[model samples]
Target: MATRARPSACSHTDRVFLYADSLIHSGGVPKLCPGHGAMPPPEGQNMINESALLESQSLRNSVLERTDVLDRVKALSLLPDGMHVTTAMVATYFGVGLEAIKSLVKDHRTELEANGYQLLAGEELRSFKNLSGLQSHTRSLAIFSRRAVLNVAMLLRDSEVARQVRMYLLDMEYLARTQPVDNPVHRETVSLDDRIDQRITHILGKTVVPMFNALIETSGEHRKELIALRAGVQRIERRLHQHHTRLQRLEGVRDDRPTVGVMAAMDAMNGRRFEHHIAKLLHRDGCTDVVVQGGRGDRGVDIIGLTAAGQRLVVQCKRFAPYLNITSPEVQKFVGAAKVLHNADVALYVATCPFTPEALSIAAETGITVVHRGLLEEWSAGEPLEVLE
Candidate 1:
């Protein structure tokens, strides 16, 4: 019979706060700004009562039982400080309309803002616009921290989508409380490293577990000799650790709008997937017409579209490994194709990786705008691109 593994030294208290970390700051959860949005119909605090709280909490537990809930909400990312999700992300996760979410915020503006709904303004707003590649005329953005989302979910009773999201929140919180992840040290919370470790464990179970099991049973008298096998396992662990560390570093370095969402997407995608990602990003950035010509022979351009301003834009995409740098010859060809052959008003050379100094110099001199990881992050995250002449 297989032995039941002993539980690690992780605390239940740690697990309980996994979702609570959204609010309940060290000092205390603060109240929302007054007059931020229209009042809650003068219903007073009676609309959401203690029974609603209990029901929501019960529902939270119910949602937690399903294991794939987190995976379904794909926007969950560990920002530099903590796990973060946005209002748009919440809507997407619940399969609700964005305008519905906006309406919810409009109704419960004070309560949500108290819970950490951020209204971007001034330079921060401008920076966000630039990073997201948003044209000058796009609507202003409203971002909510994870806690704010939970508050809105709890009170949102009208929309079918909101009802689903409320259940999702309850289930997530309950799961975090009842089923803490079993790590080596028994961490109650899930972080990027924990997720990476889970992947490593899965890989090892598929490839190394059987080998180790057989070795343990067969090597009886020769068990001491098996010490050498430890080296191989250690190597595998080291490689996994290196990959995880690299990903965390990349995520940590960026403190921009839509930070990890764009970076993670770029790093994880390639070839046709990368092409589609670019197209989707363009659409999100308000491009009226965007097309991807995959497996093509017409011209050097991989993406052709019209910018929101009706400018004819030709985009050539280079999906490459991080180690590979784009060179000047590649730039020169695209420049000619975009400007001369296609008769485009703007030419964009986009690469998943970095560009060689010579390529950068050539692009600058020829007025061929190069979009590398940084610019790609900006554009993909919804910043408007300023097409160089």
Candidate 2:
């Protein structure tokens, strides 16, 4: 399939392109340009003196060496022909959650499909369905081609796995250009330094390079580690916020009557006792066919029922201490299992404790109603169950 050209690594300007071309041959030595940060010389500057040329050759060698090491990283494919990787494979390689990968694909369906995302169909899909025993299902499997993977890596801004994949793709592109050719005549005519310089020029102008503007020169692997570290810090901050919210909820509403009563009621109920209470509450809310799915394989939804309006409703009850907040992933999973898997028209996520901001956001997006203590009190007092529009 024909794919659109990736964005240029450098800025999208004629001057940047021209300067990027000469940067490899001019040796992008550490220089204090007036406006540009660690960029090449201006358009009309003659900075490629004899000494600079030698340094450019050395820099070219170093880039090639680093690319060679990247070539040995087994996660990268080595086939001369372009290698296609599936979305599942990419997720596994990066140690990212599969649901997150699927979410990215869903959000960028058009762009990703244009860049070589394939939905298994016709003979291939039929064979897969037969093998996987999904013969009854109509949905086709979505797979990402090599370029499509790179495209997604560029767009998955929140994932550290995608960052590493970006680094890998850049390194592989560099290696492909720098690899020695088999043509003896061409090899002899073009010196290794010239070939390396041309490859560098191509990378600077054509490829979408990750911006690393530090003073210290870093290897691709080292740069990937740094990105992963930065992502880790962000994750830590998110976790801390969740924890802080949990702490505040657990201790913040001590003086409030309704919240305190809810906490006391939750503390008194064990697993089986909690299910019994949930069933009673759901029954009292005019739900027929009320079922307590409190077993080991309850599919994450603890309660199932039908409203008076004959709408299918699913509920996930959490009988936890107030310090524990239900997370976004849990909400996402519950929403998926309820609405998608169980054919629920709407869902109620009941928890004694308050929800995290991320969880509330997910609930809002997925149309799942979060029933906190305050809402539960209203429901128990004969108020009809109402979801926010």
Candidate 3:
């Protein structure tokens, strides 16, 4: 990733050889480097493979931000899917215990899923196992892409392989910062127009959306029209997103798709959209018969789903401001409907906001899994809750 001034003593051929050697030995995916067509292992190939980075959150952030390096850490043996690896393979590649890998996934499920981690279940699980030639009796399987594996490298602490990858990333970063750029003409990723578009989207999200909500709430006669108007804005926003995705794909790196994940997309969602989003996440996590039930006369239940193990699940979704907190009274209503009326085997109260201490206590005593902002984050990131089992 570093472009340096060629030293007079180092011939172009020697530079080519040296750079190629670095990439190969560092286990980076082979790529044709520019000019001499030699590739240097993208800085931090191993960083994605290991989960430990000397206890520095900044380092992890750095690795994630520079996903251009995902393909550099080559030598990944993928299954029949050609795009994903099982949890077992990841453990073998990192030379750590399977539980260790699972632990990292549990701790940083949000980040990993943002990159490409997934859990396969039901028909998906059966198909994957059949295609990959795996014979396992497990009801679900965890999988990761090269991108997700690289994320794990940044979080894992005990692997020597991971350490080497981190060291490689550091060297390249130092060289990049210190070396002079040959091109004097400035290059930019986002243009002025693009920034303006993003700003407009933010205004629509933070301002216009709440206004529509208020209008719909107060105006009994015009409520339906206001809702339709809001839906049109949402469609426009999604179309703009499609255009943005096209622009991103047209960029230099083919593997480097735009970094937008479901979490960021959820920020633009209104109450109804948020309910559907949670329902989709539950389905992705292997829930069967998942349904969104948010509406008048829904009796406090916003979602209904079945866990992979056949347990009945009922969920209540609250799409409040992130800074707000759910009160015990709010949670108590969900408990009565979910536990007493529906006889839910597992009840989850999911909110975009945090829960009050008393609210959390009530959830605990009532056996309701409180999926506050943090827990919902991980669940959205692809990690199923323990109760889902």
Give the number of the best model, judged by lDDT. 3
Estimate, for each residue in 274-350, the C-alpha lDDT of model 2 and write its tens digit: 77777787777678898998778988788888886788988888876543578999899998889888999879998
User: Where in model 2 is the C-alpha error above 4 Å?
Assistant: 1-262
lDDT of 2 at 375: 65
lDDT of each residue in 1-389, candidate 1, tens digit only:
33334346533322222212322223122233443221122212222332365355443333332322233223344222122355667676556777878888887687667666877777776765544334455355566655565565566565443443443344333222332222323332335445546455444533353344345334445333433453355356545644544444333333342333445445545578778877876776667678898666858888888887888978888777544689989999888888889998878888866788999999999888889866776676667776621
Candidate 3 residue lDDT tens string, 1-389: 55545567853334433454454335343332334322222454332212345466656666553332332222357764344789988887777999999999999898788888999899988866765556789999898976688777777778754543454455334333322223223233345556455555545544554455455444545445566676676556545654554343333222222222333334345789789888887887789999887898787798887999899999998887543689999989988999998999999888876788999999999999998765776787667788876
**Model 3 misplaced regions, further than 4 Å:** 1-262
- What are the per-model numbers of colliding residue pairs? 13, 0, 19
